[model samples]
Target: MNTQTYMQKLELLAERSISSYSYIHSLLEELKPLLPFAGACCTNIDPYRLLSTGAVVAHNMESIHHQLLTYAYGQEGVHSYDNMTPSHTSVMTLHCATEGQPEQSSRYQDILQPAGFGDELRAALLYKGSCWGYLTLFRKQDQSLFSEQECQWMVEIAPIIAKHLRQFSLAIPFVNEVKLRSPEILMLSQQLELLSSNSDTHHWLDVLRQHEGITTSALPRSILTVASMALTDDTIFDQRLHTDCCSSSLPCSPIQVCVPVREHDYIDITAYALYSHTSSIQLMIAIQSASPLDILPWMMEDYHLSEREKQIVDQVIEGLSTRKIADILHLSPCAVEEHLQSIFAKTKTTSRRELIARLLSQTDCIISR
Candidate 1:
């Protein structure tokens, strides 16, 4: 194995110099010479549903990618990750494997083997001691199994991977230009309108496959599948402020997504209802940035801002004027100004633009234990 090469790559990743598109795909290829895995996948899972919303999978296995989007998670209660621990496991050979048998499971027979993988190793991506993401490597059957020292090597690098990944996923960057004019209305504007109005899960899936891209009239099938997997039916029809109104506050906005095939690229997707249709929900994609408002709650708690102050901060980031914020929140203009002053002081920012820059420039991601 090339230890020197591995260390150099690790150092680069730690510096966050790796482009978003190559985050996992490029890293895995470098590690493969040492570990000798023919296939790999890196994933970001939603803690609530334990579903992978975004993933980077081996490009050669395009069909396998499809299965990944629809495949029921079989690793649950099967790996140390099920308990949200930082550990690595060889699906069939690990000593602590308590599940019936990894190789005998549906995931192996239906998904792994069909993709030409004979054995699988899952490495945990834990943050603050809980599994938030994962890295999986696959080897052909003719290859020898992974050794203990290699597994140890994986364990040693887990923290570095987790830290940078967290930064990458939550980054909205310190953009000189922060546009809030509302994302452009693309070809799916009509479908987005329909979904926003009703948010029927079935219709949402169909609409995903039909999104117009920069050049093409519709997105690629694989991209659509990735979007489908990321935008869960439940998350789409989430809690509504009113039955007739659009989706209420997302737990977090601009969901973090990893498109592995696209150079391990990361994108943040936010849904909005356009025009006059309150229920027509359309997805707005930020190619490599998080939504500025998504980072506000974390700042609010850190700076000890009150709920009213937090609301004002959110509106300010949304580019609303003091008068507009007051109107929307039903607070008097004087009260809104008072809250803004308190927020500015607490956040140590002199103006609305500075507040957004401070928050978006560097806010930690949430990773519950």
Candidate 2:
């Protein structure tokens, strides 16, 4: 085929293969005319399990097929292939993962003598830092040996196959092992969202504190942070109106406050803050029901903000001037101002007052245990 035609055919084949279960078998059948192969099979390699997915055996060899052949080769001990005897039984497919390369193994002696086969090749499929599975192709006695070109083709296409297989596996829903939000947390999140939409800073804070108390009573490890943006522009700076407060004796995790509304070319600014404090200025608040150290990972995952932003946000909320924030964070005041500009842009608040009010208002609803 011409290069363009070949490329088009490859794309069409890939789309078909991805769409149906029988496509792989059909693929092998098509390739048989091009390469010297009797049959082929695909298997998925879990940590302790090998599952055969698609298989095509040569006529009348169904009883001793390639699927069973490969499985027997992998199993603990059958002693049928003497030359390829079990040198390693539990070779976890780590080589494929580390190098992003496929490993090929073949034994002429074993194939010719005990196995009564001509030649075989095993190609490992690696994708996304894991070994997805392997593909095995066989040839009969009269057939020609697999060429270097064929091996290279198999290696090149292994990643594509692995990706497709991974996607297909993920598409299969696991009804038996699904997680859902608890009724209480769902209700509490919704109630907090509602309260945050309407309340003032002071009232929101009180409600948030009560909610924090309840949450601590239930999930002793949970922390709450509330902020108010009641006077802040929700479009520019989506801030919280109230956040839960906790005592130093019963410290909560440091809540990283994030405002997503962009302003002045910034997306959002985030900072870690204490939930309970003695200040009345209340620009932004961070609450913790868990230890500060324990909260960092959660903050990273939950807010998806960087450490630098978190530091800046924390300093800003603590009533620190831009210079102070820069000094503490070891950044130039100009740099701090740049980050703040981005923060203001993202939060949609032009000034600190508006930012704080918005944050405080949003965190108004909280459920204490």
Q: TM-score, each model?
A: 0.52, 0.35
Poorly placed runs, candidate 2 (over 4 Å): 1-11, 17-20, 47-61, 66-116, 173-369
Provide the lowest-lDDT 10-residue window in model 2: 260-269
lDDT of candidates 1 onward, in order: 0.51, 0.39
Candidate 2: residue 74 lDDT (0-100): 36
| Clashes in predicted model 1 | 10
What is candidate 2's lDDT per residue for 1-369, written digit by digit as tens? 333454455556766753223444555665666555665655433311222222334434444442244334332122222212122221222122223221223233333224455555656666643444556676665766566566666656666665555444333221212111111111122112222222332332333334222222221111121211111223212122343344331212222332111111101111122223343222222321222332232222223235576577667667899888887888899999887777666556788777555444422211111
RMSD in order of candidates: 11.0, 21.4
Q: What is the lDDT of residue 201 in candidate 1?
A: 34
Best candidate, lDDT: 1
Instruction: Summarize candidate 1's per-residue lDDT along 154-242 as a digit string, tens digits.
Output: 77676667656655544433332323233322223322222222223333233332321112233333234333433443444444432
